[model samples]
Target: MLSLTRLNRVRSMDAVNDTMIVEAGDTLLQAREQARAEGRVFPLQIGSQGSCQIGGNPSTNAGGTTVVRYGNMRDLVLGVEVVLPDGDVWDGLRALRKDNTGYDLKHLFIGGEGTLGIVTAAVLKLFPKPRSVTTAFLGFRSPDSALAFFTLLRQRVGQDVAAFELISSTALDLVLAHLATARSPLSLRAPWYVLVELASSRTPEDLENDFHEVMQEGLEDGSILDAAVAAAEAHAMAFWRIREEISDAQTRAGGSVRCDISVPLSKIPAFIEEACASVLKIAPDSRMVIYGHVGDGNVHFNPLRPVFESAADYLQRTSTAITTSVDAIAMAMNGSISAEHGVGVAKRDELLHVKSRVELEMAWRLKQAFDPKNLMNPGKFLPRLECVEALKS
Candidate 1:
C-alpha cells in the first residue's frame, strides 16, 4: 500500500448546513473529523486515513474501512472543483442531489484516478453521528468457516454489519512477532480470525448483545471456533488495531506481491481454493497469506517467498507468473483483478486484457472529452492512444 502523501496546505470550508469544501491537500480523516467537530460527520474514510489525501480518495473513488454501509467516497461527494488538463477550471460545485440540468460531468473525474483532472476541492456530504456501536473479534477453524460465519452474521445484523475483516494465522503471527504490544485475541490457534463491527442508527437496539447472540449460535452450529467481544471502548480499539496493522506486519515478513481482488460472495470459498492451488502449481514453494473484507467479497491475496529462498530472486522470477495465473482465475470466475485498489500503473494492462475492445474505445472517448491534452495525471489508468489522423500527422 502506498503511504499517505504529505499535505502542504490542508484547508476546509466553514460553511453551514452539513456542507463544506475541503482543499486537495487535506487527508480524508482530517476533513471528516474536522467536519464532525462542527457537529456533522463526513461519511467517507479510506484505509490510509491518516495520510491519504482527499484528492486521491475522490480520484481513485476509494472505498475504505466502512464501505459496507457508507458506500465509497464517490457516494459521499456532492460536487468537485477540478482543473482540466489544459489548466481550465470546471466548476461543477453544486450541492444539489438531483441535478439534471445538463450531462453529469462530475462522474468522469471521480474514478478516473486523476487521469482526467486534478481535484482541487470537493463538497462532501455529512451524516448524523451513529447513536450506538459494537465491535467483535471472532476466530474460525478455516477460511470456509469464516465465509459461513459472514453469511450468518450479515443475515442477522443486516446492513449494520459495517466491516468484516478476515486475518490469516501467518498474518497474525507477524503482528505478534514484529509488533511488541500486539496480543492474540484468541487463546487457541485457528486458520483464520475475523474482526467485525456493528453500528446502529437507533437507541433501543443492543447491537452488542445481538452480535454476541449470533456468534453463540455460530459456535453451536460449529461455524465459529472461538470468539471475544470487546468489553469497553479501549478493547474495541485494541481489536481494530490488529486489522489495521495487518498490512504493515505483512510488509515486515518478506517480499510480497499483494493482490486486492473481489469475487461473488458465494464463490469466495471456492475462489480461494482454486486460486491458491493454481499459484502453488506454478510456484510451489511460495507462502500464501489470504485475508480481506469477506463480507464485501474483496480479498488481499498476498504471496511471499519461503524462508529458504532469496526474497529478491523469488519476486524477480515468479512475479509475472503469479499475476497471470491469478488474473486468469479472476476472469474465469467473473471477478475483478483490481477491486478496491484502483488500477493505478500496476494492473492497467491486466485491465485491458479483461475488458473488451468496444469497452476500451468507449472509455477512451470519455477520456478525450474531459482531458483533450491528457496532461492530468497521465499514465495512470487507460493506455494512451493517438487519434488516427493525429498518428498520420
Candidate 2:
C-alpha cells in the first residue's frame, strides 16, 4: 500500500481543478475524497479503495463497479509523474485533458502495472457528483436469465444503468453463512441474482419510476422472477453489500480457483454454460460460483470444493487444467483472458499465448522505450526479455 494520507503536493490551477502531485503511496479513495472536498469528484471507484494506492490503480488500470459509466482508471487520469527504472523522475503531471504535444507518454505508465516505471504522482480528472440514485435486486433462475434481464434493462434504461452485478446462489450462501448479519432478500433461493444501480448528476430526475417500469417489463418478459427495489439510501447500501461482500465470503469459504474474464454480452450465457460443463467433467462435485458485472461482460468465475476431495488437493491439481479450459473458451469467443483485474504476474503467460504478434511487438517496444533496464515492478504484467528471446530461439 502506497502512502496517500496527504498528497505530497498539489498545484492548483483553478478552484475546482488542479494538478495533484502524489507519491506512489497515495490511496485512490483519499485522492477522490480530497478532490470531492473541493466540490469535484473523480469518476473512478474500485474495491479496496482505501488500501489500493493511486499508483497501484494506475499501474493496474483497474476498473470497478462503476466502470459501466466511468470506465477504467486510464480514462480518469490527466497526467502522471514517474521515476524511470534507472532512477530518473519523469514529471509529466499536467491538468490539461489535451496537450497534443508529442507522444501521449502517460499511456505507457497508466496500465503498465509498474513494469516500465514507478508512478510517483498524477494529475487526475474530476466530475460533478450525482444527486439522486436508485438500486434494485432481481432474482433469476440461471446465468441465461440474469443475462437476458441485463439486456432488457440496458435497452430500456440505457446508460442510467450504472451497475448490473450477478450473484450466484452458492456465493450468496457463503455470505449468509459467514457474514453474521447477512440475509437473503427473497425467501426463495434462485440460481442467480442481479444487483443493479442507476445514478445521474442531476437530482429529482425520477429514476425510481423509470427503474420500476423497466423491472416490471423484465418480470413480465421472464427476464426476472422477482425484484426488490431500494426505497432509501440505507436500503440501497444494504443491497449493494451483498455484491461487495463476495470476495471476503469467498476467502472464508475455502481455497478457490478464480478467473476474471470477459466475453461479448450476448456470449455470456453460453460462456457460463460451457465453462461450467468443462469444470464438471474434471471435478464432478465441485461447487461453481460464477457471478460479476454482466453489463461489462466480466465474470468472477470461481470453482470451489468437491464433495469427495480435500480443498488443498483440488486447487493444487486443477490449477493448470482450469487455466487451459477457461482460456480456450475465452479465446474462441474473441474475448479477453483478463477483463479488468489485469495480468500482473498471475496471467502473464496466458496473455503471451493469446495476444497477437503485432500487439506483442508494439507493447515490448513501448516497454523498452519507457524503461530499458526494466527495474520498475519487475517480473509482472509483460513477459521478461529472456522469455521473448527463448520464444524466438
Candidate 3:
C-alpha cells in the first residue's frame, strides 16, 4: 500500500476565496486545525476525524454530523489532484466558485472509493467559523415525536440548526452502562432522544435564546418529554459524548450487527418500527441499539447479542438474517442500504442486489474506462465481473 502520510501538508489558505489546498494524506484533524488558524472552519466532523485522512474522506464521500448543514465530502471538495492508473498526475485543483468548463471531472474520483484514481491532494471549501454554538438534549416519547420536534426546530431555526441526531433509549442505556463518564443530561428517561445543536456566526446569547425558545415550545406541545440545555461548552461536549461513544459502548456491551441505512425523512419512524419488529422476529432476545444523524435521514440500526449467547454463536445465527431483513425494509421504503458508509467487501453483495442493473453497468463501465486493468484498489467497492461469473459457475 502506498502511504501518503508523508504527503500531509496544508499547501495554502486563501481567505479571499474561502478555500484551502490540503494534501490528501493530511488528517481531518490537521485540516480543521489549519482552517481554525486561518479564522475559518472545515465542517466535516466525523468520530474518526483524528485519524481519518482527507483523501479518504472524499473517496468515500463521507457524511458526518455536520452534513445536514455543509453536505457530504463531495460538496466540501472543490478539486482534487489524482494519480491516474496510468501513473500520470491530473492536477485539476482550481478554487473558483464558478467554472463553466466542458466536464466536471473531479467528481469522477470523489466518492469513487479509490477505484477511479488515487487522490493525492484536494482544494477544499471552507466556511466562517461559528462564533457561538448551543446544544440541547431532549427526551422524546417516541421517534414520531422526535421527528416532529426536528421539523419544528428546522422551521423555527432554519439554517442555524447544525446537527439533529436521534438516539434510542437502549443505545443511551448501553452508553451509561459501559462508559464511566457517561451521564444522561435529561432528568427523565424516555424511549427516544434528539441531540439538537445550533451554530452560527451570531452572538452566543442569540443562539442560546433560539434554542431555549424552540425547546420550550417542543416540551409544551408534548413533542418532548424532558430536556437539558447545555449551560457551558463542557456541558455541550458531555451531551455530544453520549451520541459519539455509542459504537464503543456497543463493543464493550457485546456482539453487534450494525446496519447503516437511510430512508426518506418522512419514513424514518415507520422504517425504525418495521426494522426493529423484523429483527425481533428473528432474534427475540436481541437488544436493538439504534441511533444516527436523523437530520440527514441516516440511522445506525444495530442489534446487540443477548446476554446469554456467545459472540460467535450470536453472529453465526443472527447476522445474515438481521441485516437482510433491515436492508429489505429500507429498500421497500425507497431508502438506501449503504447510506453514508461506503460499499466495501462486507456490502459488495448487498450493493449488487440493491442497486439497479443500469446503475451497476454504468459504474462498471466507468471503472473500466479509468482503470481497465482493475489494478486500482481492486475488489473494494465494485465486484469484478469475472468473480461474479465464477461464483455463478
Candidate 4:
C-alpha cells in the first residue's frame, strides 16, 4: 500500500488538448487543483475527494454529485497504465480523444475494483470550468413532486444543471440535530427537498436570472412549495454542506443499514413508497433515512435502528431482511442493487443472487483471464462460481 501511495505525481498537463496525466495515487483533490491551475477542470466532485485516491475513483467508477453534468470517473478517464498480476506493466496512456484501436482495454479495470490489476496512472479528460454558478434549495410536497421539478428544471436549463440532489425531511432533521453549522435555509419545511446547481461559462447575472425565472414558474405551478436561492458563494456552500454531511449525521444518530441502489427516474417514487412500506412491515420501529442523486436515479435508502433498541439486536434481527427488501424493489424496477458503490465483499452474494447465469459466467471468465492465479484482490468482486457447479453435481 505504501508503494502504491508513493506513485502520486502529475506526469504531464497539456492545456491545449484539455488533458492531464496523473498517477493513480494522487488524491482526487490534487487532480482537480492541477486542472484548475491550467484554467480547466476535472469535475469529479465528491465528499471524499480530499482523501480518496484517483486510482480508486476509477477502480470504483465513482459517480459524485457533478455526475449529472460531468459524468463518472469511467467517462472522465481517457487512458490508463496498469500493472498485471505478474508484475508486467501495460502502459497504454494515450491522450487522444478518438482512439478505436481495439477492445478498449482501459474499461476492463475502470469499474473492476482492482480485481483485474493495479492501475498506476491515467490520462484524464478535462473540461472548461464553469465561470458562473448558482445554487438553490427547493422544497417539495413529496419525492414525486421533486422528480417533476427536476424534469422541469432540466428542460428549462438543459446542460447547465450541474447537480440535482434529493433530500428527505428525515435527512434534513438529522443534519440539524447533529451538525452544529447546519441550518434550514427555507422558512417552510416540506417532506422533500432538492439541492440544485446551475453552472456555465457565461456571466453570473445571466445564470441567476435564468434560475429565478424557472423557479418562479415552478412556484406558480405548485411544483415548488418553497425555495431558498443562494445569494452568495458562502450561502451556496452552506446548502451543499447539508447534502454532504448526511452520512456523518446518520452516523451520529446511530449506525444504519445502507443500500446504494438505482432505478429509472420515473420509478423512484414508487420504489421508495413500496420499499419503505416493506421495511416498516418487517421492522416497524426502523427509521428510514432516504436520499441521493435523483437526477440519475441512484438513491441511498438507509434504515436506522430505533433509539430504544440495542444496535446488535436490531441489526441481527432486521439488517438482512431490510436490505433484501429494498434491493428486491430496485431489481423489480429494472434497476441495480449496487449502483456506484461497486460490489465488494459486502455485496458479493447479493450480486450473485441478482445477476443472470450468463453474466456471472462472463465475469468469472474475465477474472480467470486477468488474474489466473487468483492473486490480485481475490474473493472481492466476483464470488466463487464453482460452488454453483458443485451444488448441481
Candidate 5:
C-alpha cells in the first residue's frame, strides 16, 4: 500500500566525493542521467532502468549487464536511509570511503527485499565516465566456445570489458518474432551468441585497437563464428534492443518456466548442458531459452512451452518439476538458485528445501529482530505460519 514514486528527488550530489544521495523512488534512468550530467557514471545498467526505482533496486540487489565491471547494487551503494517497522527513521546515509565505527547496518537493507525496512534514500557510488565505448554482437558454436572467447577477450581488455552477455539462438528467435524492430545482428546461425561491450576511461583510439585485436584473435581461433561490430551509436542501441526485449518475447511465445540461477564462471557451459537435459527429461519438446550475464556467472535458464502445448496444460504438467530440476542442477554445482531476481512469491517457500538449517535460522532471527509483529511486507521470502509464531514466542 506504500508507494515511493512521489518521493523521487536528488537529496544531494557531491561530485568531488564521487557520491550522490538520491531518494529511493527516483527512476534508475533519471539517476544515471544525473550522474552523467555531472561528468560521472552510475554503472548499474538494468533493462528496467527507465522505470525501476532506485530504492527497490537495492531491495533485491539488482544486477544488470554492467555487473561484469561494476559489481551488483550491493557494491554500488555507500549507505541507506531506512524507516523501521515501528515508525522510526534510521539515518545512516554517510557518504564515506571507509566507516569502521560500527557494524555495516546499511548492508542489511540493501538485499533485504523489503523484509527489513523501507529504504527511503541512499548514497550511491559513482565512477568516472567512460571516454570510449564499443559494442559487438558475436556468434559462437556453443557456450564453451563463448566462454573461451570471453576469457581471451578479458585477457586483452581487462577492466575495459564492461559486459559479456550470452544469448541462445532460441531466445533470439523469440525476440525477432515478437518485436517488430528486433533483428539478428549477425548472419551466422550459431547455437550461442554474445553481446559484448567495452567501455573505458581510455582514449577512443586505444579502445578501438583493443576491440579489433581481440576480435581477430577470436575469429582466428574459431571461437567467434561471425561478428557485427556496431558502426554507430544507433546501431549499438539496436543490437541492445534484442537483449532487452527477451522477457516480452517469452510471453509472446507463451510463458516459460524461468530459472534465474548462477554458477561458477567455469561451470556455465556444463550447467547449461545439464539443465537443458533435465528440462527435456521432464518435457521432451520444451525449447531451451538460455541467456544471461556470462561474465558474472548468472544465467536465465528458462524452458519455453512446446509449440503444441497449451499454456494452462504446460503449467499444470511441468512448472514445479521443471523449476525444481533446474534449481537442483545449479545447486549441485555449488551455485545459487536465485541470482539477480529476488526470492519473490515464485521461489519464496522453496527456500526451505535448498538452504541449510543454520542459514534459515539466522535469517529468521534477523526478520524477528527487525519486525517482531510481522508487519512491513509480511509473508515474503519466508514461511508464513512458522515465522509469525516464532517471532511472537
Candidate 6:
C-alpha cells in the first residue's frame, strides 16, 4: 500500500490570501491548529480531525457539523496537486479565489475518492476567526419543532448560526448509558434535541443578547420545550461531547445499520418519521439512534440491534434488510443515500441502485481517461462493468 503518512507537512501559510497549502498526510487537526496560529480558522471540524488526513477529506469530500455555515471539504479547497496515473504531476497548487480558467479541473479530484488520482497537497481556504462565539442546547417535543426553530434561527442570525445539530432521545439514551460523564444539557425530557452554536468575527460585541432573543421567542411561541445557553466554555464543550459521542455509544451498545443520507431541508421531519416507520416495519425492536446536521438535512439514521438479539442472527438476517429499507426511503425523498461518507467498497454496489446510467457512463469514462492502466487505488468507489451494464441497459 502506498502510504503518504510521512508527507505530513504544512507547506505554506498565506495569511494575506486567507489560504493554507497543506500536505496530503497532514491531519485535519494539524491544518486547523496551523491556521489558528495565524489567527484564522480552517473550518472543517470533523470528529476524526485528530487523525483524518487532509487529502482524504477532499478525496471523499468530507462534511462535518460545521457544513451548515462553512460547507464541506470541496467548498473549502481552492486547488490541489495530484499525482496522475502516468507518472505525471498535475501542479494545480494555486491559491486563487476567482480563477475562472478552463474547466476548473480541481473539482474532478475533490470528491473523486482517490479513484481519479492521489491528492498530494491542497490549497485550503481559511476564514476570519470568530471574535465571539456562543453555544446553546435546546429540547423539542418533535422533529418539526426542532426544524421550525432552525428556520427561525437562520432568519434571526443569518450566517452567524454556525451549527444546528439534531439528536434524538434514543441516541441520547445510548450516550448516557454508555458514557459515564454524559448528561442531558436540558432538564426537560424531550424526544428531540438540538445543539446550536453561533460565531462571527464581524460582530464586535458578544452574541449572547442576539442569540437569547431568538431562543426566548422560540420558547414563548411553543417551538422549543426548553433551552439552555452554556454558562461557560466547559459547559459548551460538555454539550458538544454528547453530540460527538453518538457513534461511539452506538458501537458500545452493539453496532448499528448505518444509513448516511441527506434530503432537502424542508423534507427532513417527514423523512425521519417515514424512515423510522420503514425501519420498524422490518426490525421492529431496532433502536433508532438518529441524529445529524439537520440544518443541512444530512441524517445518520442508524438502527441498532435489540439488546437481546444475537449479533450473528442480526448480521445475517436483519442488517441488509434494515439498510435497504432506510436507504430506499432516503432515495424516495430525492435525497442521497450516502452523505458525508463517499461510495467506498461498502456502498460501491449500492451506487448502481441509486445512480443513473448516464451518470455512471460519465464516471466510467473519466476513470478510463485518467487511469487506463488501472494503476491508482482501484476495486472501490464504483461497480464493475458487468454490474453497471445491467443498470446502463
Task: Evaluate residue 338 in candidate 5 and report its C-alpha lDDT on the 0 to 100 scale.
Answer: 93
Q: Against the true structure, whose lDDT is highest?
A: 5
- Give the local distance difference test score of model 1: 0.78
lDDT of each residue in 294-362, candidate 5, tens digit only: 999999999999889897899789999999898999999999999999887778877877876567777
Each prediction's whole-model lDDT (CA): 0.78, 0.78, 0.90, 0.89, 0.91, 0.89
- Lowest summed lDDT window (length 10), candidate 2: 7-16
- Kindly state the number of residue pairs that clash in model 2: 4
lDDT per residue, candidate 6, 89-123, as tens digits? 99999999888768999999999988889999999
**Residue 49 in model 5: lDDT:** 95
lDDT for residue 227 in candidate 4, whole number 0-100: 97
TM-score of each: 0.91, 0.92, 0.97, 0.97, 0.97, 0.98
- Cα error, candidate 3, residue 331 (Å): 0.7
Better of 2 and 6 by TM-score: 6
Question: Candidate 1: which stretches are off by over 4 Å?
Answer: 1-17, 386-393
lDDT of 2 by residue, 1-393 (tens): 334445444544344464455556667787777877877777676668888887777888988887877778888778888878777888887878779999999998888887887777877776666667888888888888777777766777688778888888888887888888887888666888989888765554577667787778878877678878777888888887888888887787776788888999889989989998998887777888877887888888988876577778988988678878987898799888888888888898776689765677778887788777765666778776566656654
In model 4, what lDDT does residue 341 have?
Answer: 90
Off by over 4 Å in 5: 385-393
Give the winner by TM-score: 5 or 6: 6
Which pairs clash (backbone N, Cα, C closer than 3 Å) in model 2?
2-25, 3-25, 3-26, 4-26
- Supply the TM-score for candidate 3: 0.97
lDDT of 4: 0.89
The alpha-carbon deviation from the true structure for residue 249 of candidate 3, after best TM-score superposition, in angstroms, is: 1.1
